[model samples]
Target: MTGGRGRFITFEGGDGAGKTTQSRLLADHFAAQGRTVVHTREPGGTDFGVEVREIVLHSRSHIDPRAEALLYAADRAHHVATVVRPALERGDVVLQDRYFDSSVAYQGAGRVLDAGQIRDLSIWAVDGLLPDLTILLDLDPSAARARLDVARTRYDRLEAEAAEFHERVRAAFLDLAAAEPERFLVVDAALPVEEIARIVRERVDASA
Candidate 1:
């Protein structure tokens, strides 16, 4: 899909899996190599997406699973069109915090929706734009929750979900990595930050 352009790499996992930190480190690595790096996230990669993110992540009221999925797809559509695609075409390494995988794992598995349908909707939303590599930071639910508790005072909608929901999401992410071994680098998120960063760099270097 990239046609020899800059690579798109996404970080996926359950909440508090250290995706944000890992993505930043990877972005910095690429920048040190004199590469243009576009570090962004799913629901807030653009202005339109930021508004959608506020609604989906911070809304105090209930949102149906289907509606939540659609909102994510809408944000993805706009984010890809406005930010991701342009950066890739400019030969910039795109390091994204989340992507369609999160939608499939969270809304599909966590919410008990249809995973296949969620994937299809996302594919249609972004015109089949898939990342060249996806780094899956796998961590136990309890460990991840503890990390969240230490890191923040307020929790988002997804962060506040019960333990079982997070377990389902983690399983879904592992299943996805298993299904697409070439595209996914599954790492233990409990590892030290530098170790995880080293592992990610090795995989990325091999791919490059």
Candidate 2:
């Protein structure tokens, strides 16, 4: 997929699945190789996205499911337009923490909305800018929550959801990976951090 162009890679999983850790490690790997790496995350990659991230992830007031989905799509649209696209055009490797897959899993499945519709809206929002590779850190919902509990004293609105909701989100993530086997590298998130990073680097090396 490179062919003189930049590669876009994304990470997806339930909360506390170690996405931030893994993404930072991968970014370091690219930096060591002297590659121009854009390490960013959706819903907060751009200035506008920061506000959307606050509303969608932290707001105390209840937001409609459809509205939540739209907020994510809006963030994705602007982030891709201003940040992702330009970086790719400049031949920089883009490593994103989450993408539309999160929206499909969280809003579509967790909120009981239409997954396909959410995906379609995301595609339109980003003008079909799919990742060249997506790393999915698969982990059980309960285990993920346990990790989160130890890592943080506060939880976002999504993180504070019921265990059942997290379970649904995890299942949705696995389903998305299954449907796109070629684009996804599914790894057990229960493994040691170094082991997981090694596995991810292997796949990324092959893809690159």
Residue range with the least summed lDDT across 10 consecutive positions in model 2: 1-10
lDDT of all predictions, in order shown?
Answer: 0.94, 0.94
Error of 2 at 141 (Å): 0.9
- CA lDDT, candidate 1, residue 192: 98
lDDT per residue (tens digit) for residues 68-158 in model 1:
9999999999999889888899888999999999999999999999999999999999999999999999999999999989998999999
For model 2, state the Cα shift of residue 23 in Å. Answer: 0.5
Work out the TM-score per prediction: 0.98, 0.98
Q: Which digits, one per residue and each the tens of the lDDT, describe model 2 over residues 1-208?
A: 6313898999999999999999999999999999999999988999999999999999999999999999999999999999999999999999999999999999999999999999999999998888999999999999998998899899999999999999899999999999999999999999999999999999999877
- Candidate 1 TM-score to native: 0.98
Identify the runs in model 1 with alpha carbons over 4 angstroms from their true place.
Answer: 1-4
